[model samples]
Target: MNFKEHIRVIEDFPQQGIRFKDITTLLKNGQMYKAAIDELREKVKHLEIDLIAGPEARGFVVGAPLAYALDVGFIPIRKSGKLPGETIEADYNLEYGKDKLAMHKDAILPGQKVLIADDLLATGGTIQTSIDLIKQLGGEVIGSAFMIELMSLNGRDKLPSELEIITLMQY
Candidate 1:
């Protein structure tokens, strides 16, 4: 679908010397949005996923629809204190600051297969922390998927070797 073409590259966004790949441009277009979800769905069709877990905000945009397409339950890995129940939390470092992610305490069943989805894979800290939260709750991370990945960041190196990662576009 040439998803990369739909992404807007902004120079020095929110900081200096950083080029941000924005997906909102593609997200706002219905055709491109549908194509993206379809592509992501096709890539993970072979995986035996019991749940689709997405990080907060943007992750929810792609994750929820992907879960429906795959006919699996959706789990939300949200920012700290966002979940309205007993929750599990993980703290991690971001490029500018530290942040935490939380999930419902009973979100995943023991030994359930989970596929983590997010809009972009940057430093891998957020996704990696989500993976840890899923494991701590006894779920097995089958793979991780994203619409875009910043390859230069080398985020994949921080993840488990056995975990499969699929991305539609790389920048």
Candidate 2:
């Protein structure tokens, strides 16, 4: 579906020398949104995914639907203090600074296979922290998924070698 075309590019957004790939435009178009998710679903269908863990905000948008399509449970990896229960947290570096991500302590069970999802993979910090949280709780991260990847940033290099990374579009 050429999902990249649906993404809006904004220059120097939230900082200088940075190009932001906005997904709002893609989400506005119902058909394209569904098609994009369907494509992601197809890629992960063969994996024995026990749960889908999506980082806060945009990740929830695609992750929720993907979990439903795959008939697996969805776990929210939120910003610190966002989740109400006892949680496990991981600190990571951001483009500008450091941030922390939290997930419910009971979100993942031991030996369960998890797939991490997000709208984009830029620096790989957020997703990497997500993988750490899952591991701390004894869940194994089988793979990671993204709608868009800034290949120039080389985010994939930071991820573990055992994990499979799937991205629908690359920029």
Candidate 3:
């Protein structure tokens, strides 16, 4: 569906030499957004997924709808302190510093199969932290999905070698 064409690239966004791939342009278009969800759904439907997990913000944008399409629960992986109740967290080392992400302790039952989703795979820090949190809670990460991936970063190398990845577009 040429999902990449719908992505907005802002050069030097958020910082110098950083090209941000914005999905808002694609989200605003109902057809492409639906197609993206449908495609993601198709990619993971064959798997035995008990829940769809995603990081905060952008992940919510793509993960929630896909969760609905799959008829599975959506588990939000949020920044530290964003979630109430007992939670588990993993800290990731960012380019400048460290960032922490958390998810509810009971969000996943032991042995539940989870599929992580996100808007893009950049450095893989966010999702890798998310995967750690999920595994810490005993949820097996069946696979990971993304709307777009920045290949130059080699983010996949940071992820678990056995984990499957699905991305609609790469930049």
145 in model 3: Cα distance from truth in Å?
0.4
Q: Which structure is stronger by TM-score: 1 or 3? A: 1
- Cα lDDT of model 3 by residue, 27-68, tens digit: 999999999999999998998999999899899989999999
- lDDT score of residue 7 within candidate 1: 96
lDDT string, candidate 1, 1-171, tens digits: 799889999998868878988889999999999999999999999999999999998899989999999999999999998888999999997654689999999999999999999999989898899999999999999999999999988888888999999999988
Instruction: Give the residue spans of candidate 2 off by over 4 A.
Output: none
**Cα miss at 155, model 2 (Å)?**
0.7
Model 1: weakest 10-residue lDDT segment is 90-99
> In candidate 3, where is summed lDDT lowest over 10 consecutive residues?
89-98
Rate residue 157 of model 2 by lDDT. Answer: 95
Best by the TM-score measure: 2
C-alpha TM-score for every candidate? 0.97, 0.98, 0.96
Descending-TM-score candidate ranking: 2, 1, 3
